[model samples]
Target: MTFPYDRARLDALVADVDARLATVEETARAASRVRMRSPGLGAADLAAISRFANSPDAPRELKDLARRVDAGELSWRDVASGRAADDEGVQRALRTGVPDLRRAYAAIREGEDPEDVVEAGRPRVVGDDEDGPSRFTEDAW
Candidate 1:
């Protein structure tokens, strides 16, 4: 499948999907920050950030970033580093996964960079404490 790298299309999709995945920051605030912070990043980076920010085993950077967004110390756009993980397999999948989206039974498959592959179309935040800002959730949901 030939993957189209339309920056505007990818950006719009990422922006919308990313906002839906965020539990703490509102859509407008998050979009502004993510856009401003990730000026040079590609759609894959935004996709990864959206996934990373909500993963159970999210990176420290992502966790901190989420908190900053919740606290209004930073915007989601501000956390966008445009720094996609250097995993070609995941990058390729992210670049062209939509073609085989139906067969996407496993995201971040073997040989894929755990950090680079994103669970696209997801709207849940596993890392966000929607109840408050404490970096980690202490209460059972």
Candidate 2:
């Protein structure tokens, strides 16, 4: 003889599945929050970097670094955390481009204009010397 359908058992199974699904969702959300709390680049950080990368005054090295990040060849978190400094490209960017990038990022975080921050960080062009182009402070380089 065939067994009859058990409505009560089916309802219990459905409720169990629902509970499991809710638990999984909550775990995923908590994990996401934890990740955000960790030291890393956020959405605003990426946006600020992108803007600096696209700016007319941005150096080629910085643009290359930013492009690597956009293409997933480089991790923004690693870059921000200084873990990517071993790379040659990163080394070059760090000399000038990275400092400006940091300034821009900080400015954005502080609710200031990133463009102005980047511009202000740039080495001012002093009077041109007969020897060559204008001189800049050693720190600027």
Candidate 3:
């Protein structure tokens, strides 16, 4: 049976699936790291099983893939709670991050040395301009 699609519903679904995929990718990466950097987890000592899954990036295929994955235990609840849980979880994370940004900004406002102020004050994911990428970022802020 085909399920209905709504903006909020789809956004939430995509976010949930994104989170699940990220978790799986994390597990895979950790296993790989332990194999390479640690002991016991040899190159071949990875998980017993692995499979491909589709995503919103491949919308037409994602619903089907999600249905199949939901047949399992851990993923089953994620499927059921997909929309609401993802929506609230994302909202909460973003809501919490704002305070961190504000605190950093506040600290920057109190700096004696302008350069040191911006350097130790705030962290940004994407810097302002990439023209001179190596140039000190404090010049931008």
Best by TM-score: 2
> How many steric overlaps are in each model, in order?
7, 0, 0
Q: Report the poorest 10 consecutive residues by lDDT, candidate 1.
A: 102-111
Instruction: Give the per-residue lDDT of model 1 (tens digit) for 1-141.
Output: 987799899999999987777844676677775532212444665465556556776555556555555676644444333233343332443344334332332343333333333334433445564565435332334
In order of appearance, the predictions have TM-scores of 0.24, 0.42, 0.22
Q: In model 2, how large is the Cα lDDT of residue 135?
A: 69
Top lDDT hit = 2
Model 3 is weakest, by summed lDDT over 10 consecutive residues, at: 41-50
Q: What lDDT does candidate 3 reach at residue 81?
A: 33
Q: Candidate 3, residues 1-141: lDDT per residue as tens digits?
A: 987779898899999999999999999988886523222222221121112224333233334434445554234334223343454432443344446435543453443333443356444445566555554434376
Model 2 residue pairs with clashes: none
Off by over 4 Å in 2: 1-41, 97-141
By lDDT, is 2 or 3 better? 2
CA lDDT, every model vs. true structure? 0.49, 0.72, 0.44
Give the higher-TM-score candidate: 1 or 2.
2
